[model samples]
Target: MRISELKKKGLESLKGKWGKAVSLMLLLFLINVILPYIVEVIGSGGFVQWFDQEGTPLWSDIFGTVLSIVLIPLTIATTWFYLDLVRKGNPEITEVFAIYKDGKTSLKLIGGSILQAIFIFLWSLLLIIPGIIKSIAYSQLFFLLRDHPQYTILEAITESRKRMNGLKWKYFLMNLSFIGWGFLCLFTVGIGLLWLIPYIGTTLAAFYDELIVLQEDEQPIEG
Candidate 1:
């Protein structure tokens, strides 16, 4: 599907659902941003003290790394929630934590996220462009894992790479299409992000749906 169609589908799916979408975004911010900032402040005695202490920066980095790793499942679950919303139009708010309900799935998501990050980082060492390209190539890994629970981390990664082939530029452009909305969000002092994020997430889910259809059509016939 074209980017315009995907975006239209996303907007249609979000109709009558903006409140819930914005609420979910706020909850995510509480968990991913506010909670971390609070923890860092407490750890350093206060926000101002974070910069005053000599070794606090190192500890802050360590804490940030560990927190990000722990949050991998939540991150993927958020994606799944958006996918569900795009496809079904009424995903439960609890769906944002679905990965945690399955221990094995949570582990797979965490491991896959770590490995994906490492691969991207290694590619980044070569140059910024390759890293960006590879990141886009692996962009579908989490969605693939959500759809194919039986897939191993490496299998999902490999398949995402294959599926993204010849479509990286299109995907990149699809994301770039959001730049205008992103800039508009700046005028709201980031408050507009609650709406913009869900807009982007649902559009991405539509993109994935389109890719799946393309994949099915590309399959060779079995005579």
Candidate 2:
């Protein structure tokens, strides 16, 4: 699908659902952003004190890192929620925490996320461009895992890399297409992200759906 069509599909899916979508995004912001900020403030005593110290408390930084790692499943859950919204048009808010209900799935998501991060970091050590390319290549890992329960974490990572072949530039362009909206959001003091986040998420889900169709079409027919 063309990037325009994918974005159009995302907007269509979001019709009559903007409120719910924004609410979900707000919940994520609370967990991923606000909660961490709160932890940092408490750990450092206050912004004034933190400035006097000249750096964040070591324990605060460590806690933030550990919290992010522990919340990896939440990221996958967000992907799942958007996929469901695009595919079924009625994604439940609870879907944001669905992965946590399945211990094994949660573990797999966390492990895959860590592995992908390490690989991207290693590539980044070589150069920024290679890191960006590798990050795009692994972008579909969560979606693949959601759709293919049988795939081990490594298998899903491998499949994401394989399927992204020849499509990295297109995917990069698709993300670049959001730059205009991003700048506009800055004008809103980031408030517009409540809507923009869901728009981007649904569009990504649409992109994954297109990839699945393309993959199916490429399969050789049995005699």
Candidate 3:
């Protein structure tokens, strides 16, 4: 699909489901605010000083590794929640987590994330620009697998590469739209961006869903 058409569909999808979208955005905000502390408390004994005196043991490293593992599923849960709001019209946060109750979907999301991270890391060795380019290139990957659960990691990565071709500028510009807000958050010590993060995330989710999820031969349904 053309960039213009994709953006139009994203806007239409947002307008058509404004209420659920708002609720989803709110739930997302709440989670983003609370989850970091929750994870820290659960993982870190609730205080930075908890680690200050420790020279760092294997157990602590193991604990941190396990925590990182746990975050993959949790992150997928949030991404799934947002995508459900966009595609299935379901606004329920609980239900989004519940979809991965079977655990398969969450695994896919985690695996995709790991692979994307690997790609980003390898690309970064060339220069920071390549890393950023790869990050944006594969940004839609989670959304793609969330919608099409059958996609393998290789398939999703290949498809992402294909969809990103010739549209790097478009994706960069779309992400650039949020740079001001992101910078504001950075300047304010990141508290300001918490709420806006989920909204912009879901909106961008809607953007990719509208623009690139469909098969190359398929046309988007009229809004």
Candidate 4:
């Protein structure tokens, strides 16, 4: 629960398992590229058609709608994948996909993703600050779900809320702390940005695991 301890552990995990972290980032990038491109092609005018068209194509709009539907689940899978690496120190890039390979996990990711998306989107309407707060607030929901797959969605969400209490500011600062790394990456003309995403992501994942995950079977008892 100590932020300093979490930050230290995250740094250590990053130093020890950077290669796998990088691979995960690469996979995410590839997926980001492919899904949009694929969707564009499936659109009425085709991927390139939108560029020349006066207005957006019907297909493009449809693609956007469909993507909205799929994005949540993908987000969940990525969250779990990254956290697994952090928690176990065993970096398996495929763990994310492995979860999706099963129908139940896939559905769970989709459900959680959609719900979070809506929550985040609503929070954003209050102003940008609330949006960021919501992001950090819901950030650990995926990790909770990953660790306790048996729990209902509502249960996992409630746990995230509890753990995040009085610590949202701390989590936000931790997240903000990555901005320097991001800026450094940008200074390299985005060459470093590619690596930065994975590096920062794994580091954050490590931070969450160390600070929030319970290693013992029994809950900590009050004095």
Number of clashes recorded per candidate: 0, 0, 0, 0
In model 1, where do residues sit more than 4 Å from their true spots?
45-59, 217-223
Model 4 Cα lDDT, one tens digit per residue, 70-138: 655665666565665566657476666666567887788778777777888999999998988787777
Local lDDT at 70 for model 1: 81
Query: TM-score of predicted model 4?
Result: 0.78
lDDT of each: 0.84, 0.85, 0.65, 0.68
TM per prediction: 0.89, 0.89, 0.71, 0.78
Tens digits of per-residue lDDT, candidate 2, 52-72, equal 786667888888899888788
lDDT of 1 by residue, 101-142 (tens): 888888888889889999999999999999999999999989
What C-alpha lDDT, on a 0 to 100 scale, does residue 151 get in candidate 1?
75
- Which digits, one per residue and each the tens of the lDDT, describe model 3 over residues 1-223? 5544544445554555565545655665565555554555556565675446456555656665765665576666666665655675656556655755767766776777788899999999999999998888787777767666777877777777777777788877776676777877787776565455555656676666666765556432221
Q: How far off is model 4, as Cα RMSD?
A: 4.1
Model 3: lDDT to the true structure: 0.65
TM-score of 1: 0.89
